[model samples]
Target: MDDPYKLHATAMPLEQRRAALTALAGKIRSGGTELGWQVTWNVDYGDFTWLIGGHINNIGDPFDDNEFSSETKAVERAVLDYFAELWGIPPPHDPQDRNSYWGFLLTMGASEGNIYGLWNARDYFLGKDLLLPEHSSGDGVEPREPVLLYSVESHYSVGKTAHVLLLETPADVGARRYPGQCPIEGEWPQGVPATGGGSGPGTIDVHALRALVEFFAARHHPVIVVLNAGTTFKGACDDIAAVNEILAECYSATTGPSWQTRPGNGGRPDRRSWYWIHVDGALGAAYLPFFAMAPERADLESGIPVPAFDFAVPGVCSMVVSAHKWIGSPWPGGVYLTRNRYRMRPPPFPEYVGSADTMLAGSRNGQTAVVMWDFLARNSYETQTTEAVTALRLARYTEAKLTALQHNSDHVPDLWVGRSPWSLSIRFRRPAQDIVDEFGLSGMRVQVQGADRAYVHLYIMRDTPRDRIDALIRRLAEPGAF
Candidate 1:
């Protein structure tokens, strides 16, 4: 009989695990694996070596700081400045915002970065302008609500901020667009209600976003539009420029008989009509410089490019990217960059600039800041192109395999490639819950999420291998694993 706890009974000692993993190295290759995500939970991090969990491949972890040195701080600033120069912008500001907070800072992940963008956006729209009545004093200004609008495809952090940040914020704000962030568990709701029965802007379509912006502007509300540069699971980007143009056009619309027009002939534009677009680029933003230089290959879904999202785009206000995922940077590591440094739409600062906080995560790893610079300095187009091509090959390969499985198994639905070149998802005929649990046991983890139960995602790379990937596919296709 099996032991009381099969896994514990079968646990491999550290030395044994090292040996087993050392032997498996030949079988594993980056971007070719079922083992890549597995390695995430396996590899542990200490010193410069990353050998977390059960996985024991010693990937170098450059995002560490062990000392307090002015020279190192200077190096980080210089490197960040260098990156900012690459963007054709002023040098990146220190997180301390010494000179200005108008640029970028390293983050723990794109999720935290998105939260940060929303927090700033909320202040810009509601708090800073005396939009809230309590802040408006002798000016006789009544506090008004700032509405946050985004496609459902936008990062969850937006919603988190809506409930988590704005709820604490003094301004009364609500989320519009498709999926409203109003509390589902509570009563009377809060903020703005969705216009189209909350079906959400369908499929990141720009037209839907345009219509929503117009509807809200008609109410004279301050608005901020968030665009998904790299949606979590699907990896698609919203057409940002088109969305901006739509909001701008609506802002200029002058109609509504003689009465509907405001005191200034209603032709006077609502400065608040100027909407912001913060790209939630968790998995994709770091490769933007690469995309900016080489648009042809980079624009492809399987290639790395900033094509549809970035600060380079005229209207994009802010963006975030995850270093922990593709870059192998340690946890709680993400970054945010913004073109607007001084424009605050929220409270506490009527004349707003960037936050004094270096990151939304305060007292953060100054060490990671140095290492992030190192990664960027060492990151080259050549390495990215190689990684992109490999990831694409595996994604395309898995697509074919999963598609064939669908034909044979009626339960397995259509398995499609993700929106990004570097990511892919597989949909099975069976329930995603079962699939999730099965993968857990095998240490071949994937996600069964993204607002759909039928389609499950199998992200490739980091440290996974082709053999494990094949094994996962085979097991999934078999009768029992489902």
Candidate 2:
């Protein structure tokens, strides 16, 4: 076979290129049973096929239209409005209202949102005016350098974002990566340890987090926390409400007279602590609200619980949700939402775009916004509730079947199987390589009951039906499957 990864110096014949694409499309259709990821496979954008012919770019802010006539800012605004209302923050009624929500469509999924949110938090605490020159001075008490805190279970993007933003981490400070602003910590060298052995798997330990926040808050360092609404592997959500309470407590403790009374004594009381909470809700934020609103649809009596991790929670400053995860899109895209009060002022407006470049990527895909709008408009609140309920029900059914296979099998009597609370994924002993490839399963190695074990997980999406689950179970029941 020719090297598919290589690019030929000369362009390929049009007939040959068309034949290759047609063959690839057949492969994709045949492998549609791959249900190991959190993406909805049953999506058809045939009505929007005309968009491929035009070059549409949503340059600059989604709420503001640039000179480019082909932009879809209006549809993008409607999409943002839908998410803002869903996440418990009202949409921007007026462009000048600082209290209303302000955000833009993301081109690179949740990673871009994470970077943008943390970048804003870092600048906000550092007292750097976004619209001013690099060395321009600010008119407030200069805050100490900020520290980044996130659970070990968070997506890899969080740690990468920390590095990109130049924020201090436990490992960075210990290795003397930079000036090492925050004091050294104990036990959590990589990141904040998560609770997995206990009932709340993949969730951040609130007590441990509170202690860490207090240690930094007392030392006068601003803190930035990245909470997970639905983790990648285990699908766990951290307790945002509990973390907010801890921040409030630390804030009160740091603002005492002992820290406030300085030599400057400008008669203006100063706050000694600053904190920002950004929720990385790539999977859950898109559909969890519907589960919350219609709890009667799910089997909540079985102990699975849905927690709040949006703007409704007092301390949550910003959040990001992927359109390709819960809500299916042809390509990777998402939205990053934050209040206008928290939006960092962009650098001087660009005349080329005729609008302020507030978004991370100045040029974004207008087609993503239009697709998201179409999905939201076609699916009403009740329809979303039904879909969410149905997905959860299928997940429960799969878990039950897997558990039965473990108990009933004599060859693999000790088969390990588990699922986190309110999770759409189920973990079991890793099957043979052929079965894994056939079903598109994701594999991981973890310590289970004090021993290393290989596990594979299956994510139940809207396209994952009961028959597909049965087929997966049948493959696992084969002789020597484990």
Whose lDDT is greatest here? Answer: 2
Clashes of 2: 0
Model 1: how far residue 180 lies from native, Å:
15
Instruction: Write down the lDDT of every candidate, Cα atoms only.
Output: 0.49, 0.78
> Could you report the Cα RMSD, in angstroms, for every candidate shown?
9.9, 4.2
Q: Write the per-residue lDDT of candidate 1 for residues 151-212, one digit (tens) a residue.
A: 55555577777788753211233323323432332222332222222222213655445545
TM-scores of all predicted structures: 0.64, 0.90
Candidate 2, lDDT over the whole model: 0.78
Runs of candidate 1 with Cα error greater than 4 angstroms are 1-72, 82-101, 104-107, 127-144, 167-203, 254-273, 288-306, 343-362, 408-452
Q: Candidate 2: TM-score?
A: 0.90
lDDT for 27 (candidate 2): 83
Identify the candidate with maximal TM-score: 2
Cα deviation of 446 in candidate 2 (Å)?
A: 1.7
